[model samples]
Target: MELKKPSDNCFTEVDGFGVAICNYAGDQNHLAILYKNPQKPDDVKLFHVNSYKSDLLTPVESHYLWVDIDWLPPIRKIAITANLKNIIDNNKDTKIRYGFSFNLGCFDPVTGKINNFYDSADGFTCATFVLEVLKSLGVELVDWNSWPVASPEDINFKQYILSQLESYSVKYPDIVTEEFLLGQKNKINDPRFKPQEVIAATKCKEASTYNSIQKPAQLVHEEVLSYSN
Candidate 1:
């Protein structure tokens, strides 16, 4: 995979599916899948699972850290893109919730079914959503079995999420419902797949050889600096 800048004409230069990583404030990041529209080959789009809302598959205008999977053959790329479009079409009306878990939830493209840790609703964090999509495409970005159990920091993050949800529920009572809060609370202890870890995994030549992310925040900072340079 090759990371390209906004000025690199990545949309036209690459003719296949890619991954986009966007860094945000508070050391947060987001992951999404990028692909060209089959009907309009020149139009590139992005698909991602977001928190507090349903999943989105929309066109790209914002610049992100575009990682082009240039290693794939043209035929394979076409097939993957088609499969992704089908997945999107099938789940167009499905309300996919946002939740976290240590386990990378399962996504079955054939049946258009999703199984997450909570098992209450179709849930996935932005990172896991992107990972599952790539997994469906026969691309394993990280070794699922290699991830360690939840740590103290992981637990703390879970608490943070709970608190944030509580605050949001109070502030936006209509949007953040009791059911949504319960679903998120159910998987609070599950191991998390951070966005930086996903970004690091993409750098690995093979998913099996990738072990773990030592410091996610530091890696994210470095990536941002590298992109800026």
Candidate 2:
């Protein structure tokens, strides 16, 4: 089930929230958002967690996806599940949930650009958009730092999402590697890994910020890890 390690995050204080997962193989792949509810985390409302494993492969496409909150019915909310379902056999079995409370802000209703979201220091809040919609909806701004923990095994859905994304991230380059790209060698062949997307989606970006400060793995923000060195 591509469930490598769990992410240490707590996205929601309420019952249901959102999430995203991606898996890639060769030149093909898939990504999706998981609408998770506390009532039935295993029987998730949307895509299931183990869905990534059905498409057996020696090597697969590892991609990024996110779980962010969105305004729904002006009171209710939904997730803006952004991902590529590159496989044909996406299982409906286990739908892993996320603890991150951040929601997606539309740049153009289809792009994952950070044109609007903002971050606060209150801790454990959702990803931010410039607008005060959530506040208007009665969601108090939380300290962003209280989101991500180190290892997912300590947390429930946080570990699940992180481990899954790590699994996919590890495989993404194999299918879309330099050798594979040199064949076509086009802009689209540039499979830039979005560690930030994984982090942002899981609400672990802020935690990484603290982690990097503690370890200083490199001297820059997490752009494309391949692009970093």
Candidate 3:
């Protein structure tokens, strides 16, 4: 759910789900993911990413979170928003690298290792964060007209995400694009972000498509455990 409009409240659940509240103009930027336990109404899990968390990633980055429906306890609904207070740290006391803007803390006991944990990409800007999250869910928004389309060698993450969001807003006019662009401005939206790459020829079409496309899900051999109602 892209919280772009004044009355956009519902979140759609597909095999993949996403929630984004762009608050660029706000004093303190925050993002939170909440999970309520069905059997015990009082028990809840909260995950948060904000300016402070983003600041810890060296040069800093815009972060995102994606939770699988199967791994979670059944719940009637979820609340995703910006700027909630006093929430618990979902990754507290865990060996998993929790502070980075981009994190994959899902653990596998058999391997004694965490899946999708921190690496160089943890320095991603909001744009890269959104792109990676979408890629994880089998969607590729990358195209010839994609934002910050600099040569891969000179690509900047923040510019890329902002550009992508802008394109999405134009592509889906029914969805509000303004809110998606309103969050705390990234530290890197400089002149480099404005240059539009000209597609002189389709010579690199196949390679470009491959880079922009998502990896096939079947290639990852991880076993996914699921429970039924």
Candidate 4:
């Protein structure tokens, strides 16, 4: 599906899955899943596993370039939504902490099984979460092997995340446990897939190499806009 600005009927016009791409903190590009509400067919909502509180589902608003998965069949789309609902229901009390995983490719959506690294982190970045959900439905958005391994920058980012986790645990011990911190430490050198890589993948027909260094959000945003034109 091509990325384009949402029309006035952006919500009511669509009936299935899509991706909402927008900038966060005026710096990085972020992604969230857009799906038609099963109860209210005309309404759409955003489902994402963000670093903020684990509010997985919410109404769709704001200015975002909506990438609707127009190729999927209607029945499959409904199933995907149902699956997500079930996941939310099951994890109602448990908070899915926000963290990145290099082992996303190893996740088994059918069994809801994740690698030890992901299980320890207890969360996902918004982009990985969206990709994981899509992967559950047999939708592979990017070539996992073509992507570069983790770089020194990524390693430093891991250290930053560890510090954040330490602070979070001190403030909210009940939420961020010792086990969680250990999990975050397990995959220190793992390669991470950035939000821009996902955006660029949408425009590529075959496996393409991606730069190890992260690109500016605006550049990626403009590239996506150019694709729609």
- Report the error of model 1 at residue 226, Å: 5.3
| Sort order, lDDT high to low | 1, 4, 2, 3
Candidate 4, superposed: residue stretches over 4 Å from native: 7-9, 73-75, 78-82, 88-91, 102-118, 203-219, 223-229
lDDT of 4 by residue, 37-67 (tens): 6776876877776674577776676666666
TM-score of 3: 0.29
Clashing pairs in 1: 102-191
The regions of model 3 sitting more than 4 angstroms off are: 1-16, 26-49, 52-122, 144-229
Query: Candidate 3: global Cα-lDDT?
Result: 0.29
Candidate 3 or 4, higher lDDT? 4
Summarize candidate 1's per-residue lDDT along 46-150 as a digit string, tens digits.
Answer: 788766566577767555777766667679888888887777767676665566643444657576555443354336778888888788777787778776656
- Measured with C-alpha atoms, the lDDT of residue 156 in candidate 2 is 38
Q: State the TM-score for model 1.
A: 0.79
TM-score: which is higher, 2 or 4?
A: 4
Tell me model 2's lDDT, rounded to 2 decimals: 0.29
Clashes of each: 1, 37, 6, 0
Candidates' C-alpha lDDT: 0.68, 0.29, 0.29, 0.64
Q: State the lDDT of candidate 2 residue by residue for 5-115, as single tens digits.
A: 123333232124344333333222233333344344443332322232232111211233334543323224423111111111232231212213233332222332223
Q: Number of the top candidate by TM-score?
A: 1
